[model samples]
Every structure is written in C-alpha cells, then in structure tokens.
Target: MQTQRSFAKQTTGTLYLVPTPIGNLDDMTFRSIKVLQQVDLIAAEDTRNTQRLLKHFQITTRQISFHEHNTQARLPQLIATLNAGQSLAQVSDAGMPSISDPGKELVIAAIKHGIPVVPLPGANAGLTALIASGLAPQPFYFYGFLPRKTQQQVAALAPLKNRTETLIFYEAPHRLLKTLASLSLAFGEDRQIVLARELTKKYESFLRGTLAEAKAWFDQHQPRGEFVLLIAGNPYPQTRADAYQHLNLHDYVAQLVTEGHPAKTAIKMVAKQRQVAKQEVYRAYHQF
Candidate 1:
C-alpha cells in the first residue's frame, strides 16, 4: 500500500473506498459500517441510497453528495478534508466506487496530493458473475460496460474477439440482446458466452451457452436488471483452431491432461477453445 506523505502532514487519516451491496442490505460489511460511523465525512454517489444504508447501520456521519455531475466540483473540497486529517469514505449507489462508478477522479486527486487511499472489499457484480460464470477465470480481463451504439459496440468488441483470456463485461438490460447479437456477429455463433442477470437479487438467473443460444434466450425472454456478460476466450491465430480439427475433442482434452491440466478441467478448456459442447467431448472420451 502506498502511504501518501501529505497524509503524514495531517493526523494520518484514510480515504476508505467502500463497496455497498447491489441488492441485499445484509451484504454491507461490519468494517464498512464502523468506518462509515467513524469517518469525518462520507461522500456518496446518491445521498438517498447512502442514507438508507446509513439508516440501516445507525450511522450519522455527515455525508456530502458527490456523483458524476458534481464530482469535479467536490474534488478540491474532499482534498481539503483529507489534508486537514479528517477521514472520509467514498461510496457509489452500489458496489465499490470508481469501478464503472464515480470517485475515480477523487481517488486520483487524493493521490496527487498524497492522501492515503484504502479500498475495503465487499460486494462486486463483476466478481459475483465471474465466480458463477463457469468460464475460465484465470487470465481474464474486466471490461466494465460496453457502449450502446451498434457500430461502436461492435468495434469495441472487435479488438478483443481473439484474446485467449476470458473476458467479462457489464451491460444494461434493454441492450442485453442487442449486445449478444453484436457479439454473435463479431465473434461468430460458436463463441461461448455466460450471461449473469439480476445477480444477488430474488430473480437472479444464469444463462450459459454459445453466442447463438444466448441470443435466442434473450429474444424469447425480456431481460431484467443489470447484467454481467462473460465470454470464453477465443483461441488465438486461425492456426490455433486447427489443433482439434483432426484430433477430435477427447484426444484434445487428453493431450491437454498429458501436458498438465486435470482431465475434467481440461475438457472444459478444450470446450471453450473449440466452442463445442462438453457432452461431445465426453462422448469422444468414452468412444475412443
């Protein structure tokens, strides 16, 4: 952790970046509650949202409104608060602040002035989705949210279409199907996808399939809530696709296992790389 020297000029207080729950109030951390109560000030993306959290925790700390519209204006005031040795905590409407949320600017400003920034972990929609996505978690990138425009969005995904690392994205409900359609066009029907919607809420759902399958699901059912889209990485180079073409799926998994990966996980790895059904791999394993 980088300790801001300017933080030493004052009594050495921290700017805690707190994570709030996306859905359930019970997910708030005890440490977060304690910090909120003890901090000199709390800056929230939405005062009303934070107010409810505060009310639930019985915290009465003075809160200043800071969000996208007013964040620039509040930067100086927040810096001054930290320089004066007053502890402050920053929160978005939900989840950790500044991760596709507001407060990145404030965090940067604080660092420029040498104010200590501490991140307290709690609920995060991306991590929540990735954990259950059943995709390769290692070597993955977190792309917060994609743009709404069809061409722009397609262009955005074009660069990452062939990355070997798993990719995660946050998306709005109304555009979910459109985004899926664009992905199908950009990555092709065989691209493996995992769609996590309404996470951590009563109507939570998980839809995992090929790009074509996900598009069909989206068309039949109206999406609800914020969504996290996880795409299994594409095998690099057109030549990379040649490995399993002649090997059949089982031999591919077996070869992967011979190299090192466990048989079960290797099957999944091969499935993602080939963008085929795991059942096909299983059948191949037994027949030959």
Candidate 2:
C-alpha cells in the first residue's frame, strides 16, 4: 500500500488535486484558488471550459489540456514536470479531480513514481445532493454516470439492486428521464429517489419522491441542466432463493454438468454465480 503525507516536504513537486466549483463561482475555496495560482502548470479536462473558470478568478497560471482523449500522450509530460520540481494542479470542468473525472490514471502514475498527491476538499455534487436528499448519508456508494445504453445500464444496476447503502449517480440532462425509468425497473417502482439538479447554481432544484413519480415527472417536463441522482438503498432483506444456493462450488458445477450443460459452460456459470474469478473456478472444476 502507498501512503501519502500530503503536507510533508518532498523532493519532487507535489500534485495537488484541486476541486473547482460544481456550479456557483463563489463556492471556490480560498486554498483551492491559492494552489491554482501557485502551481507551475494546471492540467485541465477541458481547456476552453477551464479557461472560463480561470478568467473569472483571474488565475493566469498556464494550463495544459489533459482529457480522456489525450491522457496517454500528456501523462509522461506531466510526470516529467513533477519530477523536475514543478508543481501541478489537476482540475476537471467541475468538482474533484478524479471522481468520474480524468485524473485517476495520472494520480496512479504519480504515486507509483513516489510523488506526493495532495487533495483539497471542495464542491462535490454527489455528497452535496446526499446531505439534502433525506436518505441515509453514511455508507453511500458513489456510482457516477452509469452506462448510456439501456441494456448495459440495466445490467449494471442489476447487482446494485440489493445494496443497502444510499446510491449516488451523475447524469446529463438529456439522459435523466431514461435513467430514472431504468432505475425504476431495476430497483422497483416504490424505491425512494432524489434528483438534485443545477447544484449550487441559481436554478438549483431537487425533485424528491418515489422512482415512479420521478419517471412520471420527467415524462411531462423536459430535463434541463446536470443531475445528481440519489437513490434510496434496498430496504427488503436479501433473499437466498438461488437454485444453486446450497451447492458447493464443485457440486454446483457437477450438478450443471448433470443437467446437460457442457463442462466449460457449467464452470463459467458457477464462477459468475459465486462471483469468483473464472480461472479459480476453472482450476477447481478441472482438478477435482
């Protein structure tokens, strides 16, 4: 495990994870602004968008474009700058640097190279929406931006259907209605949900109700602005109704084989149901 002493003096320059405002410009923190001005270079997800933020705050520090498309090519250069004792601040269009943002890979590389990473607390849409969401706050699972396709999104939400902790998700305005409908189908119609939109901005609003109500509301109104979807966790006790629930790993595969499934197919199914690595299941099934 890698440990980071954020404030400790380091031989190489520190990588500051600065959080910009999610909506309101006044939400920018003093420390975040200070770091932005002091850093040698700022790596931003969108240069044009970040430029507007920089202009508003009068921060003239040079910015390099470091987004999903260009991360691979830009990573080495950023690392080299850090090694040269030139501090860098990484920022997304809004919120924290790496929460569904474009700084995780770079952060990993920095840590692997023994560079210190310092994160500053600021505006986060997920947490901001959660506190006011009237849902359980602790033990929340931040699942930012689910897959866009309907089938993929449903498959993704299937596993999370049983989680007890509050769930947070981010989605664009265009997909809000479709996502709410999908959430309704996955978690059922009665599940409680809170939709926080345009957070910290003048038009900030929250729509709190059941999943069914949310779907119906968006069906009537055209969704505008970004959304923070806070879903109440599963309230019912988890059921143990699987057909293979009582079977041992080996026996489970054996039973599937007995039922006319190919050995390889049975092994794969067992691995999926048990949530173990396929290789582990394959080894046990073949050897025993």
Colliding pairs, model 2: none
Which residue runs does candidate 1 get wrong by more than 4 Å? 1-12, 238-288
Candidate with best TM-score: 2
Query: Where is the poorest 10-residue window by lDDT in model 2?
Result: 235-244
* TM-scores of all predicted structures: 0.79, 0.85
Tell how far residue 6 is off in model 1, in angstroms.
Answer: 12
Q: Estimate, for each residue in 1-288, the C-alpha lDDT of model 1 and write its tens digit.
A: 765543354565679999998988888889999889999999999999899989988999999999999977898888988888789999999898989999889889888877788889899998898888899888889988888899888877766776888899999988888888888888899989998888888989898899998888777888888889999998854443564467877777877776567888888877888888888877787674
Best by lDDT: 2
How would you encode candidate 2's per-residue C-alpha lDDT over 1-288 as one tens digit per residue?
Answer: 768887788889999999999999999999999999999999999989999999999999999999999989999999999999999999999999889899999999999899999999999999999999999999899999999999888978977888899999999998888898899889999999999999999999999999999888988899999999999988884642274689777778887776578999988888887899888888787774
